[model samples]
Target: MEGSNEELNPNAMTAEQTAALFSKLRRRRVSVAEVEADIEAGAPTNDAGRLNLLTYTAWMLKEAGRGE
Candidate 1:
């Protein structure tokens, strides 16, 4: 599932990479802006401005459980 020249690091992906990776996994179109919005909404990202798949997924699941 290596779509780009640079191997995607699931533990530390840029928003675009994250969106692309997730869109593939989910079989749906996930936009980079949406990922960026998630970061703005407090989805956790590493200090290097990269997202960890597990952490981000956990945050999303937690948010969903909140039912807000």
Candidate 2:
């Protein structure tokens, strides 16, 4: 089910799209500024400046462990 959803959904998105989708998924307000800040802080993005959701999630999880 998850794989099918993954296949149907676009992997790469602009910061605005990413923020909107993330806000929907998390049921919270995710501002584009926050996403852009993450990118500025070294979150991965493709050459086209679109972020890969999977890659960003992985990077975020890895970063979350840094404080520990």
Candidate 3:
């Protein structure tokens, strides 16, 4: 997967081009607080969103050494 991502990378960049290829995605990046608030509010209304919230929380706990 990383190979495919790198294959399309330009030869010159600020790590891969002076400008961001996916600027819109970069701009809309969510904050941890927002996800927590959404989860608390049951905002997803879908399985995927719930899964992502759980996964993100799990990862966070794991990184903080609070998860088994």
Candidate 4:
């Protein structure tokens, strides 16, 4: 199953690219509080909104070492 999953996305971003993007965000020190503020201020209002919220939370937690 794991092999199948990997095969399904053979062109995915490399670990280095992922690390660099996150590192850039960390250097910027973007706060989860700011993400929350944007959500509360009506950033979006559809599936995209939910996805943005999820992505923001995931990034914050990942930086904090609370994400896998």
Record all residue pairs in model 2 with backbone atoms less than 3 Å apart, i.e. clashing.
Answer: none
Question: What ordering of candidates by TM-score runs from best to worst?
Answer: 1, 2, 4, 3
User: In terms of lDDT, which candidate is strongest?
Assistant: 1
Ranking by lDDT: 1, 2, 4, 3
Model 1's number of clashes is 0
Cα lDDT of model 2 by residue, 1-68, tens digit: 22233333456788888887889899999999999999998999999888989999998899889993
Every model: Cα RMSD to truth: 1.6, 5.7, 14.4, 11.8
- Candidate 3 differs from the real structure by a C-alpha RMSD in angstroms, to one decimal, of 14.4
Residue 64, candidate 4: C-alpha displacement in angstroms: 27
Q: Taking the tens digit of each residue's C-alpha lDDT, what string does model 3 give over 5-59?
A: 5433222222122123323345754454544454564433244333232444454
List per-prediction Cα lDDT, in the order shown. Answer: 0.90, 0.83, 0.38, 0.42
Q: Between the candidate structures 3 and 4, which one is better when assessed by lDDT? A: 4
Model 4 residue 37 CA deviation (Å) reads 0.1
lDDT of 4 by residue, 1-68 (tens): 22233322222333333334445656864444555454565433345333233444455556568342
TM-scores for all predictions: 0.89, 0.81, 0.27, 0.32
What value of lDDT does candidate 1 attain over all alpha carbons? Answer: 0.90
28-63, model 1: which lDDT tens digit per residue?
999999999999999998899899999999999998
